[model samples]
Target: MKKLITATLFATMMAGTAMADTTLKLVEVITSPERTETLKSIVGKFEAENPGTKVEIISLPWGEAFQKFATMVSAGEIPDVMEMPDTWLSLYANNGMLESLEPYLKDWEHTAGMTDRALELGRDVKDTAYMLPYGFYLRAMFYNKKIFAEAGVDGPPKTMDEFVAASEKISKLPGKYGYCLRGGPGGLNGWMMFAATMAGNNEFFNADGTSKFSEPDWVKGIEWVVDLYKKGYAPKDSVNWGFNEIVAGFYTGTCAMLDQDPDALIAISERMDAADYAVVPMPKGPAGKSFPTIGYAGWSMMSASANKDLSWKLIATLEGPEGNIEWNKRIGALPALKAAEKDPFYAGEQFKGWFDELADKDAVPTVMPTYLEEFAFFKDSLAIKTTQEALLGDITPEELAKQWAEYLTAAQQKFLASK
Candidate 1:
């Protein structure tokens, strides 16, 4: 009996030594309760499958992540793996801080299941892929079915004219507005989509790097939003509504429709019943075109990681078809793996709208200007303030367009010069 006990103790010690041979530190830039739990679950499964591997996750607050990550890099305390946002991709990849995943992906069987677009999303300016995006945050229209019924609208609108008509009818309901306008922080996506659809094209920059906001079609797009606000199709107070307020407005039935990403589904599902709400593609312009903005955050490996193969395995397990679907289920984003879209979970009403848009093949998928260093300031500060001003009638749409054109031109010049 004593020998048996000693043998067991020896085995346990060997197991510990084996695990100590490989430990991976992963950083998550977008910190939240839901994302934390989801990461834990994914890592837990990876650890179980690979007995000698251990992963430790370090989550950083979204607002301070850039500064904090820079400090870590300066200190040489880089993690083995990290959640890479699009805006930060050029910075890290260009600096040689991130590992190129092309070689690994070439040998990875799981890459076969991922979407071509997702695989290309991680490419650096030199065209090397350094990250593998797990999911897409693409825009779709979320409408309150009950409100539509009460307003006597037939169904979700397919054209801009139908959208305005529906909004007018829905606003006629006592104490309810037709649309929720995001006129506050992070409002740029809404503005861009509205302008893109109205213009029937989504080009932002010319070959010479000049901005298209000053163009007639894009100006008309901005005018449409101003008209909607001034004509009372949207609530006056909505001029101050950001993400939370607009989401609340939709779920509480204060607004009939909201154009948002799939991530909004998480909050909507918590407060509203399944039957009360549904999602649909963004309405098309007079020229029959629609553009929905697409953004993604992905997993990347540090170039200095001691165990590149094992680190990539962890990433594969997280972004594989099974893992991608499971992760997106909790985070409320669309899976980067195309096969995951066929899963039963995506067949529900809440997800059908986005699926329909993807199927349409004509609705353009738009990407923001993440290559510019000043993009954060432009998105979080200048765009919000100027758009709010335009909504308030403080500036004409043409004036707003001219302001945007000047700013973008200067920013583009700076970006090019730095390159």
Candidate 2:
């Protein structure tokens, strides 16, 4: 009897070890306190559902995430699952470092409920599903109602000219600027939006695969923003401001207008009263169209993952209708799942601005050239340097535009050649 009991105990111990061996590592690069908390909550549920299967969560600070994640991967310390931003998708997907999620997505119970845009962006790298996008970041104009009223401006600007006029009017007020320009990191989107609006279309490349940024219309768009800074319409110090600074500027009533994605709402709503602010579609330009930049971040499984099925299961749990909605509620992005749109959370007045932009024929959602593997470097380094110079009058808009056109043209052509 003693011998039989010992054998049974050993068998039970081995079975427990087998179950404990299924440990999955997840890294979230867009880390925020709220986002991390919500992620942990969702992951906790995932862990609870799968007994003995542990999920190790790593939250990387957004500022150092790119370089840090690259180093981690190179050092052979790869996570099974990762939060993939659009800018990083091309590099990893093209390098074959990411697992194609098409097969899993095909059989996912909630796959049909994903919006078309979500799937389209997920397949952006090589027309293959390397990531499952959780939400979209659509740019819109956030304006302070109190500032507008104080400046005697009637309402949100509807045209580029009106936007500038309102800015000038607001600038005349003591200690107030018209626009909270994101002139530092992550400013590329604003520059692209203005350039495309003035260029009369959101087309970045011509038939010959050359960038159209150096064209006269696009140059004017660049100049228009440069002039806004030079004329004191925006805070002089804003030339060094980034995401946090601009959001703070808007909520503090130091700036009358800010062009940002829905995520800004999370911060802005916290500081300012609901009645003090509102959002609107980006102002149209001479062609009567506005091109607001749209971006997204999603979940991607690493090709190096030993347990593909388990990794995919984690992705599905996070991106499933309930998990996705909960995540976006904290992240402040539009849900990638179509059914999540019906939730009362999105039906609020604040979200009306983005929904209205979606319905407006003249409001174009401009997607950046994220397919180019070199784009992350260009946006994070090259564009920031040159745009700051342009804003400070250290370089002419024409010079800046020419440099951008050359860089983008080369990148796009190289991408085309690879295909």
Candidate 3:
């Protein structure tokens, strides 16, 4: 009997030591000052509670995240866990670069708190879950409330026509650009987002993944935008506006409207009230519906990781209901955790409204699979160059569309080979 007791005690001792000695290396592509500070604080809290496991964090900027991740993957300097971009997930997952977490996630309790849409976005078409999604990148319309009231617009316009009309009214105001847009990178810069907004307008990439940017409905849509700019409703520098420029333009009240991610609003100082600022669904165009870009940002554990179990535990902790809510609060993020999304931190109806509507993909397609072609869709193409030329008044829209069609045809063929 004594021998049996000793044997059991020895086994228990070995197990404890094994768990205590485990370590995990984690990487997060830090994007902003606020996010960087939050990352440090979270790591400290995680380490304190999770004894025996030390997380070696390596911060990489988002601008260089993809290239860095690619290099590490080739060299096998792969961390135990990584936070990947929405578009890049498909590229990694398709190549088997990431471990499938479906089996392990099956038994985890934290999933109950996650939003269904977030789950769909984080997983593959085969129902294989890859990364645990952290936040939403849903589209929203940010209108200057002061401008709205002065224009006699009760609130944001609900339909595309009304939106255009409101912009016309607002553009006449002193020192205000009715809208701010992205251009220079042209098609490369805004095609996907244009797909979403056009989705709101019931426009789309066809079954073959090709687009006719010059179709009457689509042409009309672009014409409206062009007219808006030609009339000085949109800033001339719009051709060069990137994510950074748009955010600054909106916050400074230089632009009257912006179609951007939800976090853009949350980035504003909290002292501002919903009355002064609120988000509306992307306006519907003549197509009777509008689409908006919904991006996923998340982390997945490596299958070949030496410390798979420990890495999963750390991942589970960060994506857990409580942890998700806290991290989301510090940033302007909507929690992927369904329960966390409902927490008091999200506040009233205005914020949660789109999360509820858009999560189901009723308004638009749900879970745009992450892919690399999305980045190259418009790169170095004639359509893009022509658009830039039009912005410079060197070409006509007709000539621009003709050139774009040619570039898109060739680009699509190369991209379709992999599909």
Backbone clash pairs in model 3 (N, Cα, C under 3 Å; residues 3+ apart or in different chains), count: 17
Local accuracy of candidate 2 as per-residue lDDT tens digits, 1-419: 99999999999999999989889999999887888999999999999988889999999887668788998999999999999999989989999999999999888999999999999999997789999999999999999998899989999999999999999999999999999998987899999999999888999999888999999999999999999999999999999888889999999989999999998998899999999999999999999999999999999999999989989989999999889999999889999999987899999999999999999999999899999998888887899899999998899999999999999999999988887
Candidate 1, 117: how far from true, in Å? 1.7
Ranking by lDDT: 2, 1, 3
Candidate with maximal TM-score = 2
**lDDT (Cα, 0-100) at 379 in candidate 1:** 72
Query: TM-score for all predictions?
Result: 0.83, 0.96, 0.78
Worst 10 residues of 3 by lDDT: 374-383
lDDT of each: 0.86, 0.93, 0.66
Q: Model 1, which residues run further than 4 Å from truth? A: 1-23, 50-54, 60-78, 230-232, 235-242, 304-310, 371-377, 392-396, 411-419
Which segments of candidate 3 are over 4 A away from where they belong?
1-23, 71-76, 151-154, 183-203, 208-216, 271-274, 349-419
Superposed Cα deviation of residue 286, candidate 2 (Å): 0.6
Residue-level lDDT of model 3, residues 128-237, one tens digit each, is 78788888766667777987787777788877678778887887777777676766432233444444454344333455656565555555555555666677877778
Model 2: runs farther than 4 Å from truth? 1-5
